[model samples]
Target: MGIKAFLSEPLARYIVAQQHEWIAASREVQEKWRTGLVQKAMNTQFGKDHFFKDIHSYVDFKSAVPVSDYEDLKGYISKIKEGEENILWPGKPLYFAKTSGTTSGTKYIPISKDSISNHINSARNAILTYIAETGKAQFLDNKLIFLSGSPVLTETGGVLTGRLSGISNHHVPAYLRANQLPSYETNCIEDWETKLDKIIDETIDQPMSLISGIPPWVQMYFDRIIARTGKKIKDVFPEFSLFIYGGVNFEPYRAKLFESIGKPIDSIELYPASEGFFAYQDSQDEEGLLLLLDTGIFYEFIPTENFFDENPKRLSIGEVEIGKNYAMIINNNAGLWGYSLGDTIRFVSTNPYRVLVTGRIKHFISAFGEHVIGEEIEKALRYGMERHPEVEVVEFTVAPMVAPEQGGLPYHEWLVEFATLPNNMEQFVQDVDRRLTELNVYYDDLIKGSILRQLVLKPLRKNSFIDYMRASGKLGGQNKVPRLSNDRKIADELTKINQ
Candidate 1:
């Protein structure tokens, strides 16, 4: 390695220390962020036309700024609908990072040139930290296989509008950039089917030293790789060292991925989003550390229990409490001020801000890592128990079961009390398996030949989820059923009911 490359680890440590000092000393950053929020509230169309005369008069101006969902950005969509720059950033952004919103199927979030530079700097810091922790700077020479988003750009009036992965591919370090495989341009559309096939074909013969992507997509890619190559992943990419993943929890897919790759837990978790690149695994051995990008964005942490509570206190990096889960709020340069990234994490240490991700406060299934969401499991059960063509799902609750006799592994037992029972119960169970397999390849692998057997579909009375919700005292408002459960008592009770 060159002297510059060799010094990267020490430099990274120095930068991290400097950031901690900045957070400690800078009261101006916090004041400036709050001032920016006041300015946004004053200028906001919602606040001016509806709420109050001026931003200062608005009651709880921070709270008054309506929490925006995907639908809220529909006006801006028209500009990018024609692949043109519209709102939020100065000048045309480099490209959009295609992300799946809760309601919007696929939306392109802008990635400005400044944002790209921040991402690069954050990524480099993460690498350097890893090297510093492991004393493995020589490993940097190994090839990295990014199971990244496709590089294809949509042509609207001869203009390119797509994800930043492609744009970044053209801009990474020359030494590292030289090792990448060809892009999946032809299969780069939003359709998962086409993209999956292309990923499989491309990765089959390539020598991959490190891999990175979301866990579900990575599992799907490997499944296709195995199917197309007719060889196990170990037989192909035996040299694979690191598995870098983010966007979702890795626990659900962890066992299956290890089985397929026949690799150890040599993995790294990153906490990045379309909005910004935030934290990454500082050490190869430690869980993850939230290295505040002090120059890139201002940070805030709201305790998870205070998400919807009347008076929520926002904690800055310096004031954040350790061992308590907090939702991330960011003041990003791309015009997002005090924006919630919808991720929940807890501080592991305060000095360096090491943290562990504890799932999305809104995106958990009873705080467990089983890949089931409310809509997904409900639809699966309803479709599974189809006695008559009109058979529909009225309610359902997915409970976890650990059966030693049944392959000695934990499984999701669907207490699916349907509106109508299916004529053939076996067929219903099989249909549930098929649907789940189609949705998540990891679940499919477990059901097929791994430790777990098929998912148990138990018919319950209608209003199961509702009854459960009511019993939990989360009857109406915005409360929903827990999709996954880790509480042993709940899991055991549900498992007993299934049995």
Candidate 2:
């Protein structure tokens, strides 16, 4: 190991030990954070309006602050954007993490001085946890590239504003600065293809050991690298050993990614968002990510089944059970109280409070009462791909075909873009359909009762998703196509692109 790796080993162990202390005292830590956040924001407009002064316990807090999404908080957010002080939190926010929204056009989530550490430290601890467990710190000595949004930021109401990843760029510790790849100038390029080309120019010959990004974009980088050198990724960068990824499930892209690399490698899954860094994969042996309870955030859970209910049952950390899906609600130090994160997660292990991100709360398909989820579809696709090792998928989305243009019973339509087409497409579809039926009982009942026809897979041209995203002006920089939809909006647009 190099000098940095040798030094990090001891530091990594210390960090892991600190993490354990918090994990063991999860409830106490969360309670402390909740009290601190409430007290700090009590004098703010939102806190005063919501009677934060009267809130003393979890029950009081819950009853005082009703659950709120972006729309519900728009009034306060607008005041903050207009240079108001203490509208939501005390004083003005340090920065606003901007993101695209579905119903709302754009969202600006605040990041305060107090809450910024939560984002940075959670990510740092995840890697340190790996190093502590596996005793693998040598990778830190070499080049590490995080394929991310632009480091360039603009100002909004006197606050620096940009994508969360971009804002994080400003905070890379001095120790890692020398080892980080893809020059800042390249990162500042607005166009993704141009930026990627510049990145290839800068790093093609570097001794890179780690690469991090969403899987699809990373796959694109791998494809470009192979095209340039005519060598597998591992062959080009023998030291490249760790992949850090987030924002989507990695299962569907696994086969093609490993095939391109010519070997398997270690990976760390992260659950970072504009609102907070919620969890990170702390153990390679563990099936889910370790939720960061001690972060400057208080978490609540509502069973996903009752999530749509007007008065959903909310549970604190002590009340959450294993293997049940829950819509997460959070009150963070940044002053977002009773905020619905919109992502649904299932607790895979309760001892250390580990969770698997199930899917978006709004991104499921219940058009026919089958109620298929993103996890089920992803697993079923992985199952089919495993059975047919010859097939490689690029991207896919599912939507209900309520009225087939060809005139037939309503069914689910799968728009799939393939990296390599399956030789026996019919068998591939059958395998996927069978697995999905087994995974979702309601879907099986619908098929058996003839209420819905078997799923139909439409093979899309290569780069179909890319074309669609590009056409929508969301070609890169933390933007991605949703995996499934309840409506035909995305599906119809994809069909148009393929046409």
Candidate 3:
């Protein structure tokens, strides 16, 4: 066998073997995992305060370590930022991943050597798992293009801060360089539009097999590629068969992205955040990502319905039930302890532990007691798509049209940018409204009682979201518009931009 082929087989075998172990692991086996990770960090300052040294079981771990947010850990992280060693983890962090400052300003998350390895291995395992499942080993033959963040990193208080993609780009195996596109030098360019132009010029004629990024930015790249070459994306990269995406739900952007492709191609949704590689799309037949149970990260779940209680109960992986919204708490080798990543998820399957990312904890819309999240918006849109196959909705965001001082009930304002609007736009809105009511009982009650006005649909010019993001200085690389917001803040901003 050739060298690449030889390398691929063993990795695929290893991942498949691990998958079997994960699926068969008993509740006791998984709980022991939580204990083991806690024990490893027991020597750190965080561990000492939380009495990790005295912990013996999952019950002790949860009761001792309080669920924390970024602010709660900021003091300890500040010490690490000032060159403190062994505060959160042993020795100093090699790098700090700067998060997109959507809710909590830009956060500098420490990335230890162990955490870096976890990210890389998890990514490889994902690909190998795909190979084991689909037998598509041909994917390794062509270039893989990642439309990533600017690699030009900056130092802050002895820590390097940059986008997660830029921060992790250098750690990838050098052997894979031959098949990776957009030279390192080009990836460092600050201006996204300029960088995209350079990337299109460099990759439009290459033997590309994969394109991976957040969907909106990927759509922008696809749009440019089509415009530049005057041919379909499939024609430009015939080997381009798989799209790996994360940092946002793929459902809303899927139809818009497919409009750029000449033929059908498979896609995978990843659940990776700046903290670590959490989960990934393991099976094409499945709707949710298989939670990474064995990685350096340990997980706890706090049901969203009871999140604000004086003391919310935290459940371990083995105890979590399917169909409940839980805010995630992660403890990782990256020195994060009980850190509330602000993301929410629901267990779609419990036997093997698969989860669907529901949305961000701070990103839901509950303005009128109708709690609508990112997942609901996506599901509602998909339902609308099922009813109208011809309509190609490109991008959208929703905000509440709160009751004006003049009077009348409040309703939802949907700003949609479509590649082609449905022939019956009014029916399209009705379909969305009907689906949303079906998904949210509170919403159904409101509409039935006439307590809220019917939903309003506003068709935006194509690339309106793109234009808004670019104007806000967050046009690319894991940056996404919040799909649902409680207030009119973002909606008013976008409305003004088009004017």
The numbered model that scores best in TM-score is 2
| TM-score for each predicted model, relative to the true structure | 0.62, 0.99, 0.96
Model 3 lDDT on a 0 to 1 scale: 0.83
What ranges in model 1 sit over 4 Å off? 1-67, 70-92, 104-108, 155-160, 184-205, 226-232, 309-312, 364-499
Look at candidate 2 and tell me the lDDT of residue 218.
92
Residue-wise lDDT of candidate 3 within 62-120, one digit each (tens)? 77878888888889888998888788888788788888565568788898877887787
Better of 2 and 3 by lDDT: 2
| TM-score comparison, 1 vs 2, better candidate | 2
Please give, for residues 1-499, the per-residue lDDT of candidate 1 as tens digits: 7454476668767866765675565545555644554454343433353343444522354555443444565555446545554344444556666655555777666566656776777776666666666665544555566656556666532345655555555567766765655353633444455655665566667667677776655665776777777777778887677777876555434655776787674677777677788878876555556655454566777887688776677776667877787888775555455567777778887655678766565653332234544344544544554433434444344655665454666666766544456677787778877787776555666666665667776676544544554454433221234444444354444444445
What would the per-residue lDDT of candidate 2 be over residues 1-499, giving only the tens digit for each residue?
7998998988998998898899899989989988998899999999999998999999998899999999999899999899999988999999999999999889999999988999988888888899999999999999999999998989888888999999998888889989998889899998888888899999989999999999899998999999999999999999999999999998899989999999889999999999999999999998999999988999999999999998999999999999899999999988898999999999999889999999989999999898899989998999989899988998999999998889878999999999988889999999999999999999999999998888999999988988898788887778888889999999999999888
Name the top lDDT candidate: 2
Location of the lowest summed lDDT over 10 successive residues in candidate 2: 473-482
Q: List pairs with backbone clashes in candidate 3.
A: none
Residue 43 alpha-carbon offset, candidate 3, angstroms: 3.1
In model 3, the runs with Cα more than 4 Å from the true position are 1-3, 405-407
Q: Which stretches of candidate 2 lie over 4 Å from their true place?
A: none
How many steric overlaps does candidate 1 have?
Answer: 3
